[model samples]
Target: MTKTRRAARTAHTSARTHRVLLAAQLGNSVGDGAFYVTSALYFSRVVGLSAAQIGAGLAVAWGIGSIAGVPLGHLADRRGPRRSAVLLALATSVAVASFLLIRSFVPFLLAAAVYATAQSGLAAARQALLAGLVEPGARVGTLARLQATLNAGLAVGAALGGLALSSGTRTAYFAVFALDALGFLVCALLLRGLPALPGTPAVPGEGPRLVVLRDRPYAVLTLLNALLLLRLPLLSLVLPLWIVGRTAAPGWTASALFVLNTGAVMLFQVRAARSVTGLPEATRVVGRSGLLMLASCAVFALTAAGLGPWPTVAFLVLGAVLQVVAEMWHSAGSWQIGLALAPADRIGQYQGFYGTGVPVARTLGPLLVTTLLIGWGVAGWLVLGGIFLAAGLATGPAVRWAERARSRAAAPVAGEPVKAY
Candidate 1:
C-alpha cells in the first residue's frame, strides 16, 4: 500500500477504536447513574433493609472492593487487560442482577461486596486498555471525551430512573436492576470486539512482583488525590443536607445545583482538559482547581447568614458552578498525571493503585463532611476550604517529587549517567 493509503487506514482505525471505547463508557455510565439514583429506595422498600444497614453494608463493600483493585490490576497485567476487563464486566453484571434476590442483610452485603469488587476490577482493566489504545499525547483528551459522554449518559439514565422512582413499584425496581445488568453485558460485548492488548510481561528474576506499596511518592500522591475526590460526597451527600438545614434557599435549589453541575461537566469537561497535555500543565491545573474549590467553599458559607431566599439561592448556585469548574479541572489533571506517571509495563497495577483514591474518598468523605462541615456550620466550611487549598497546592510538588523518584528508580546502577524523560 502507498504511504498515504496506510496513513488513512491508521486514522480510520484510531477513530473506530475511539468510538467503541466511548460506547462502552457510555453504556456503563448510564447504567451506573440509573442504579445509583434508585439504589437506596430499592433497598429500603423492596429489599426491606434499614437505612443504617444499607449504609454500613455499602461502606464495608466499597472498602473491601477498594482493596481488591491491586490484585485484580495485577491479574490484568498478567492475563491481559482486554480479557480481564471483559470477564470483570460480566461478573459485575451478575452481581448487580443478584441484588434482585436479596431478602436480608447478609445477601445484600454479599451482593454489594461482589458488585463493588467487580466494578473496581473492571475500572482498572479498562483504564489500562485505554492507555494502550490511545497515544500518550491524546490520552487526556480521550479521557475528557469519555467523561463528557458519561455525564450525558448519566443525565439520560437519571431521567429513566426518575420515572421508575415515580412508579414506586417492586417491578419497577427490578426492571431498573435488569436494565443496569443489560448495560454492563452490552458494554462487555462491545469491549470483546476490540483488539486484545496484553499487559507488560514480567522480567526474569524480578522477584515476581512490582510492589506499588513500597512507592512512597506514589502513595502520597494517591492520598492527595483521595482528598480532592472528597468533592464526590461533598456534592452528592453534604451539599443537599446543608442546603436544607442551613441555607435559606428553597428546597428546589439542591436539584438545580445538581442540574447545573452536570450540565457544566457535559458542556465544558473536554475543553477544560484540552490544555493538560503534560505533567507541568496537569499540575498547574490541579492547583487552579483547588483555588476554585476554595472560593466555592467561601461562597457556600455566605448562604448560612440571613441572606434571604433568592440571594441565598444565587450564592448556592454560584458555589455549585465553581465546584463544577473545580471538578472539571481536577478530573483532567488527575487523569493525565495518573496515566503519564505510571510505568508502561505496569499500567494496570499502577492505575489500580491510583484508583484506590476514589473508594477511599467515597468511604470517608460523607462522614468528614457531615461531622466537620455540617456539624460545625460556617466555620466548618472554611476549614474544608482550607483543606482543599492545602491539598491542591501540594499536588504540584507531590508530582514533581514522584517524577524525581521515578527517575532515580529508572537509573542504571553502573557508570551510565541518569537520564530524564
Candidate 2:
C-alpha cells in the first residue's frame, strides 16, 4: 500500500477507537447516574435497609472495588487495556443484573462486590487505552470531552431514573442493568478493531513486578486525593438526606442535583478545559483548588440559619459551584500528573494508584458524615465542609512531595530529555 493510504487507514482506525471509547463511557455513566438516583431510595424504602447500613455497605463496596485497581491494572498491562476493559464492562453488566434480580442484603452486597472489581479493572485499562490512542497534547482535550459527555449522560440517566421512580415501579432499575450490559458488549466490539497502546514493545515481562509502588509521586498524590475527596460523602449521603429531612420541599432534593449538574456541564466545563493546559506543576494548582473547596464548604455551612427554601438552594448552589470547579481541577490535574509524572513503563499502575484517592474517600466520607449527622445537626454538615477544606490543605505537602519525586525520576539520562513516549 502507498504511504498516504497507510496514513489514512491509521487515522480511520484511531477515530473508530475514540468513538467506541466514548460510547462505553456514555453507557457506563448513564447506567451509573440512573442507579445512583434510584438505588439508595430503593434500598432504604423498598429493600428495608437502614441509612447506616446502606452507607456502610456502599463504602465497603466502593473501597474494596478501588483496592482491586492496582493488581488488575498489572493484568491489563500484560494482555491489553482494550481486552481488559471489555471484560470488566461485561462483568459490571452482569453484576448490575444480579443485584436487581435479588433484593436480599447478602445478594446486594455480592453484586456490589462484583461490580466494584469489574469497574476497578475497567478504570485502569480505559485510562491506559485512551493514552495509547491519542497524542500527548490531544489527550487532555480528549479526556475533557469524554468527561463532558459522561456528565451529559449522567443528566439524561438521572432524569430517566427519576421519572421511573416517580412512576413507582422497579422498571428503571432493571432497565439500567440492561443498558449497562449493552455498553460492555458495544465497547468490546469497538475495541477489537483498534491498535494497541503507543510506546509499548510487543514483548512481555518488561515492567516491574510491583511497578505501581515505585511510582512515589503518584503514590503521594493519591494520599492527598483521598483526603480531598472526603467532600463526596456530603453530596452522596449527607446532603441528600438533609435536603429531604430538614426541609418541606418534597421533590426539591432531586431538583437541586439536576440544577447542579446542568450548571456544571454547560458553564464550567469549557473554562476548566482551557485553563488547565501547560500547567506548571500539578501539586500547586491542586493545593489551591483544595483551598477553594474549603471556602465553599464554609459558604455551605451558612445555610443552617435560614429555614427558607431559597436559602437552602443558595447554599447548595454555592457548594455546587465549588464542586464543579474542584471536579474540573481534580480531573485534569490527576490525569496529567499520572500520565506525565509516572515512568513511561508503568503508566497503568500509576493510574491505578492514583485512582485510589476517591475510593478511600468513599470509605470515609459517608461514615464520617453519617455519624456526625446523628450528633451535630447542620453543624455536622458544616464540619464536613471543614473536613474537605482541611483535607485539601493538608494534601499540599503530599502534592509537592509527588512533584519532586516525578522530577527526580524524570532527570536527564545521558544528557537528553526523558523519553516520555
Candidate 3:
C-alpha cells in the first residue's frame, strides 16, 4: 500500500476503535459509579449490615473475580478473545440486570461479585482485542484515548447516577447496571470488526495457555506489576475510609476520585504516552510510570490534612493528572511488554496471564492496607506511596537484569555441549 493510503487506513482504524472505546467506557463509568457506591450504600443503609460486615462483603465480592482473571484469560486464549468478550459482555449485562432482585446483603454482594468479574473479564478481553487492532506505534495513543473516554464517560455517569441515587440508591443501582450492560453489548458487537486476536505465535506441543510464561522477562514483569500496584487497593478502599473518618465532606463526595481519574486523562495522558513511546523498552516505561504513580499517591494523601473543597479539588485534580500520566505509560508499556513476551499466536493467553494481576491485587491488598491504614491516616498513603516509590525504583534494575539474562541465555557459548552427545 502507498504511504498515504496506509496512513489513511491507520487513522480510520483508530477512529473506529475509539468509538468502541468511548461506548464501552461510558457504560463502565456509569455502572462503576453505581456499583462501588450505590451497592455498598444499599448494603449498609437498606440491608442492615454493620460497617465491618459491609467491608468484609465488598472485600470478598471484589476478590472473587480477582483470582479468577488468569483462568478467564486462559479461557479467552482458547475460546477466542472476541467470543470470550461477547460472552462476558452478555453475561455482564445479565449479571447487572439481576441486581434488581437483591433480597439481602449476601445476595447483593454476590450480584456485585458477578458484576465485578464480568467487568474485569470483559475488560481483559477488550484490551487484548485492542492490542490486536491498532498498530504498535499507535497503541499508546489509542490506550490514552480509551482512558480519556472512560474518564469523560464516567464523569457523566457519576453525575447522572449520583443525582438519580439521591432519591433512592437501590432504584438507581439497577438503572446503572442496565446501562453498564449496554456498554458490554456494544463491546461485544464491535468485536466483529476485529479480524484477528493479538498473540505470540504458538510452538508445537506446548499449549497456548503457557505462552506468556515462556519468557522469563514477561513473568518478572507480571510479578513487578503486582508488587507495583499494591497501593491501588489501598487507594481505593482505605483512602475512602480515611476521607470519611477525617474529612467533613458534605456527602461522602468521592468527586475527588472522579476528578483524579477523568480530569487527569483529559490533560496529561497524551503527553505521557508521547514520553513512554520514546523510552528504550517497555520495562523502563513501566518503571517511570510507577514513579509518577507514587507521586500521585503522595499528592492524594495530602487531602487528609483537610484542604478546603477547592484546595482538595486542586489536589484531587493534581493527583488525577499524575494518575493518567502514569496510566498512559503503564498501559501502553505493559501492553507492549506482554505482546513482545507473548507468542504471536497465543496473544489472548498471554494477555490473560497479564490480567491476572487485577484480581490478585483486589484479593490480597485489602487486608494488608486496611490493617495498616487504620492507624496511619495520611501517613499510610504516604507509606503506600513510598512502597510504590521503591517498587518503581527497583523496576529499572530488575528489567535490566531480565534483559541481560535473556541475552546471555540466547547466546551460544563456544564450549557448550551440542546435540552430538
Candidate 4:
C-alpha cells in the first residue's frame, strides 16, 4: 500500500472511533437530561421522600463518590481503561435502574452513592481511553467536540424530560429512569467496539500507589479549577434566583439564559478551543476566561440597578453571553492542561483526582454562591468575580511549578551517565 493511503486509512479509523465515542456520550447525556429534570419530582411524588431527605442523601452520596474517584481511577490504570470504562458504564446502568426500586431514605442514599461512584469512575476511565486512542495533538480538540456533543445530548434529553415533567405521572417518571438506564447500557455496548488497550504497569520504585495526592502542584491546579467551576452553580442556582428576586426581568428570562448558554456551548465550544494547543497557551486562555467571567459578574450585578423589565432582561442576556463564552474558554483550557500534565502511566488516577473538582464545586457552590451573590447583593458579585480572576491568574504559576517538578523528576540522576537504548 502507498504511504498516503495508509495514512488515510489511519485517519479514517480515528474519525470512526471519535464518532463512536460521541454517540456513546449522547446516549448517556440524554438520560442525564431526563434525570436532571425529573429526578427530584420522581423522588418526592413517586417514592414519598421529603425534600430534606433528598438533599441530605444526594450531598452525602456525591461527597463520598468524589473521594472514591481517585482510588477507582487507580483501579482503571491497573485494569485497563477500556475494560474499566465498560464495566463502570454497566455498573452505572445498574445503579440508575436500582433507583426504580428504592423507596425509603436509606435505600435511596445507597443507590445514589453507588450511582455517583460509578459515574466518577466511568468518567476517569473514559478520559484515559480517549488519551490512549487519540494523538496528543488532537486531544483537546476532540474533547471540545465531546463537550459540544454533551450539550446537544443534554438539550435533547432535557426536552424529553420536560415532557415527563408535564405528565407528572408515575409511569412517565419511570419511563425517564428507564431511558436513562438504557442510555448507559447503550454506552457500554458502544464502548465494546473500540480497540482494547492494555493497562500501564507501575514504574519501579514509584513512591506510592496514589501519586496524584502527593503532587502538590497538580493539587493546586485542581483546586483552582474547582474554584472556576463555581460557575456551574452560578448558572443553575445563582442566576435563576437572581433573575426572580433581584431583577425586574420576568421568570422566563432565566430559562432563556439557560437556552442561550447551552446553545452557544453546543455551537461554539470547538471554535473556542482551537487556540488552546499547549500548556502555556492553555494557562493564558484560562486567565483570559477569568477576566471574561469577572466582566460578566459585574454586568450581572448591574441588573439590581432597578432597571425596568426589558432592560434587566437585556442585561441578564448580555451577562449570560459573556459567562458562557468564558465557560467555553475555561473548559477548553482546563481539558488541555489536565490531560497534558499527567504522567502517561497514571493518567487515569490523575484525571480522576482532577475531576473531583466538579463534584466539589457542585456540592458546595450552591450554598457558598447563594450566600454571597444573593445575601450581600452587588458587592457579593464583585467578590465572586475577584475569586475567578485570582484563580485564573494563579494557574500560570501553578502550571510552571508543575512543569519544573516534572522536569526534575525526569532528569538523569547526578553521576549516572545517560545510556542510549
Q: lDDT of each prediction vs. the true structure?
A: 0.89, 0.68, 0.65, 0.92
Give the range of the ten consecutive residues with the poorest summed lDDT in model 4. 412-421
Quote model 2's TM-score: 0.82
Off by over 4 Å in 3: 1-14, 44-54, 105-113, 196-204, 211-216, 231-261, 278-282, 292-332, 377-382, 401-421
- Per-residue lDDT over 1-421 for candidate 4, one digit per residue giving the tens place of the 0 to 100 score: 9999999999998999999999999999999998999999999999999999998899999998899899989988998999999999999999999999998999999999999999999999999999999999999999999999999999999999999999999999999999999999999999989989999666555457788888889999999999999999987788889989998999988888999999999999999999988998999999998999999999999999998999999999999999999999999999999999887878899999999999989888888999999999999999999999999999999999998888777643444432211
Answer with 1 or 3, whichever has the higher lDDT. 1
- In terms of lDDT, the poorest run of 10 residues in model 1 is 412-421
lDDT of 3 by residue, 4-88 (tens): 9999988887787777666666655665655554655655665667788777766776677755655666666666677778788
lDDT digits (tens) for residues 295-373 of candidate 1: 9999999999988999999999889989999999999999988888887766787888899999888888899989877
In the range 334-399, model 2's lDDT, one tens digit per residue, is: 666667655555566667777877777777766676777635776775676566666556555655
Ranking by lDDT: 4, 1, 2, 3
Q: State, as a TM-score between 0 and 1, how close model 3 is to the true structure.
A: 0.78
Clashing residue pairs, backbone N/CA/C < 3 A, model 4: none
Model 2: residue 155 alpha-carbon error in angstroms: 1.3
Give candidate 2 misplaced runs (Cα > 4 Å). Answer: 1-16, 41-57, 170-172, 198-208, 243-254, 278-281, 307-312, 371-374, 377-400, 406-421
List candidate 1 stretches off by more than 4 Å. 208-210, 411-421
